[model samples]
Target: MAQKNYGKKLLLVVLGSTVMGIGIYLTIIANFGSDPLTMFWIGLSNRLGITIGQANLLVSALMLIVVFFMDRKEIFIGSILNPLVISVTTDFLLRQTITIDSVGLRMMFFILGLLILAFGIAVYSLADFGRGAYEALVFSLNQLFKRSIRIFRILCDISFAIAGILLGAQLSIGPVMAILLMGVSIQFFINHLSRPIYHYLNK
Candidate 1:
């Protein structure tokens, strides 16, 4: 039974990561903007003349260093897999640009990307395997400050968004919406979707 449950969790992690990659790809192709962390990565990529995947890996590594000191327990197989899979998948998809000339279609894609990203986050949380470096940073800060997860999450996003903007990443509607909506959306999914799925899986 333990083995079976572990297998299920592993499966969830892979699926969730893949879904997240798809969401990331969609948002990038939409050309509106991306989530805070991704925005920062893209900004760094542009400035450094590197691939977004490389920027992502570098950022994740730095965040993981902090997590190591703040809360090492959060580092697990999923932690490594999360960044590796997402970066590779995102880079591959990014290379294959799906052009959308219509502004309306781009907006639609952005909205769909946001939804997919939120759902992927919820799936990852439900698996309980481990969190990515950014998620771990948020959780660690929440633990240190004794604040609500939602508050820290929003703050983290805002900070990243600001930094990204300062680093020359375009501040657009998509990023603004992401900053405002991501924490709330993730919480909503945890309450309405992840918990239910967790209960079912454990049962």
Candidate 2:
């Protein structure tokens, strides 16, 4: 069975990738303890004496390998495309040297980043082009347990935060708020956003 509207799916993947990258960059620059996975990345980087980028790659690769055995079908174009596109987008943005000085403004960026990140994740996940290693695990658990992804996602988020803390990553209000909201945010998009995307694709 051939997949229809694969080109559109790919577009979604790219858009999601770029959006996710921007979201990630914003969250990090906001500096409110960063995103959950990012907290873990920082911990891993410091623990291993490697660059943050190196730690990120290592974690993602290991995650991808795990998902590969868990459900290879979830490994698709987006799986590869997600990290590459996000890395490029974030790298470029980093070079821009974006900075926010206002506490209020930083908070705004964090909130916006969290929402956009979840939306981006939903867009690409709905595209059926596979998912990033982090999200692949989320959805894979959804399939395996036949439960709501929100529950699994919440657990995953908290677990990462705890691990990051254990590894010396500071916990803050921003990441804590994000940990609570991220799962709900992603599910919200999957619920609301999937309709239009799938509608366009099926047409």
Candidate 3:
């Protein structure tokens, strides 16, 4: 029974990570900007002349190092898989040239990307395998400082957004939308989607 449960959780982690990757890819192809972490990676990629996937892997690795010190308990197999899976999947999707000429269509894609991203987050959280590197950092900081997770998240996003901007990544509406909606979306998914799935799986 324990083995079965572990396998199920591992499967959920992979599924959630893959979905998140697709969402990330869609957001990137939408060309409306990206989430702060992604923006940071994109900025670094542009400045350092590396692929975005490479930048993502490098940044995630560095963040994981910090997470290792701050909260070793959060480290798990999922932690190792999250970054690699998301980056690789994003890179694969990005290889296809998906373009939208109309602003409305582009915005539609952007919104869809947000929904998918949120859903992925919700599913990933449900898996409860482990938090991703950036998320683990936020969780650890919250624990250390006794601050609300929301505040730390906002601060992280702002810092990354600014750094990305400074590095010559274009600022756009995508980050703003992500900041505003992601929390709400995650909550919605947790309450409405993941919990039910968890119940079903457990039963």
Segments in model 1 whose C-alpha atoms lie over 4 Å from true places? none
lDDT of 3 by residue, 32-107 (tens): 8988988998899899998788888999899889988888888788888888888888888888887788899888
* Per-structure clash totals for the candidates: 0, 0, 0
Q: Name the TM-score of candidate 1.
A: 0.90
- State residue 138's C-alpha deviation in candidate 3, in Å: 0.4
lDDT of 2 by residue, 1-203 (tens): 24658788888899988898888878878878877788887788678887555667778888899888888787888898888777777767767777789999999988988998888888888888887888788888888889998798778878888888898887888777887788799999999988899887788
* Top-lDDT candidate index: 3
What is the clash count of model 1?
0
Which 10-residue window in model 3 sums to the lowest lDDT?
Answer: 194-203
Which one wins by TM-score: 2 or 3?
3
Identify the superior model by TM-score, candidate 1 or candidate 2.
Answer: 1
Candidate number achieving the greatest TM-score relative to the actual structure: 3
Clashing pairs in 3: none
* Local distance difference test, each candidate: 0.85, 0.82, 0.86
Residue 19 alpha-carbon offset, candidate 3, angstroms: 0.4
